[model samples]
Target: MERNLELTIRMDNDHVEIDVYEPESGECSQIDAPLSFDEHPEFDAAVGNEIYSWLSLWADELAGQN
Candidate 1:
C-alpha cells in the first residue's frame, strides 16, 4: 500500500528541520510542524541492520513523544 506520508528535511550550519506532509482529496495537510534539531546528537556510523533497528525504535519513540 502507498503511504500518504511524506517527509521533507533541511539542514544548515545552525540547525536541522523536518516536515511531514499528508496529501489527500485535493487537499494537503502539514501533519507535523517543522521540528528543529539544534541539540541533536551525532551518529558516527550509518550502515547495515543496526541503522534499520535504530530507526524503527526512533520512529516509535517519536510517535509517542508527538
Candidate 2:
C-alpha cells in the first residue's frame, strides 16, 4: 500500500493552521491544539504513536515546525 498525504499550513499574526490531507482516503485531519508556547516542541517522543504509530504523522509534526 502507498500512503499519500498533503499538508497545508496557513498562519497569520494571530493564529496557525495545520492540515493533513490524505488523498487516497479523502480524509483530512486538523491536528493542532492550543497550548502554552513553552509546550509547543513540535515533535514528541511518541512520534505519532498516540494510538497507532505511523511515520507520516511524525513527519507532520516536523513539517509544521519548519
Candidate 3:
C-alpha cells in the first residue's frame, strides 16, 4: 500500500529546503541545509532518501500507535 505523501524541494542562493506533506491530515515537515552541491554533487539524492526514510518511519510510528 502507498501512503498519501508529497515531497517538494527548493533551492536558493544559500540553502536547499525540502518539504514533506501528508495530504490526509494536512500535516507537513521540512528539512534544509546549506547549498553545497558544488562540493557534494550527490547531496540532492541523499537528502531525498533521508526524507523518504523519515516519512516511512513516521508512517510506521503512526500505524503502531493506531
Question: Best candidate per TM-score, number?
Answer: 3
Cα error, candidate 2, residue 36 (Å): 9.1
Cα miss at 43, model 3 (Å)? 6.1
The TM-scores, one per candidate, come to 0.32, 0.48, 0.53
Query: Each candidate's lDDT (Cα)?
Result: 0.43, 0.57, 0.76
On lDDT, the stronger of 1 and 3 is 3
Scored against the true structure, residue 5 in model 2 reaches a CA lDDT of 71
Please give the range of 10 consecutive residues that has the lowest summed lDDT in model 3. Answer: 37-46
- lDDT score for residue 33 of model 2: 44
State how far residue 33 of model 2 sits from its true place (Å). Answer: 4.7
- What is candidate 2's lDDT per residue for 1-66, written digit by digit as tens? 346678787766645566777786687766554433556555342325432444656567668989
Q: Distance (Å) between predicted and true CA of 20, model 1?
A: 0.5
**Runs in model 2 with CA error above 4 Å?**
33-39, 42-66
Residue pairs in candidate 3 whose N, alpha carbon or C atoms collide under 3 angstroms: none
User: Which scores greater on TM-score, model 1 or model 3?
Assistant: 3
Candidate 1: lDDT of 30? 25
lDDT of prediction 1 = 0.43
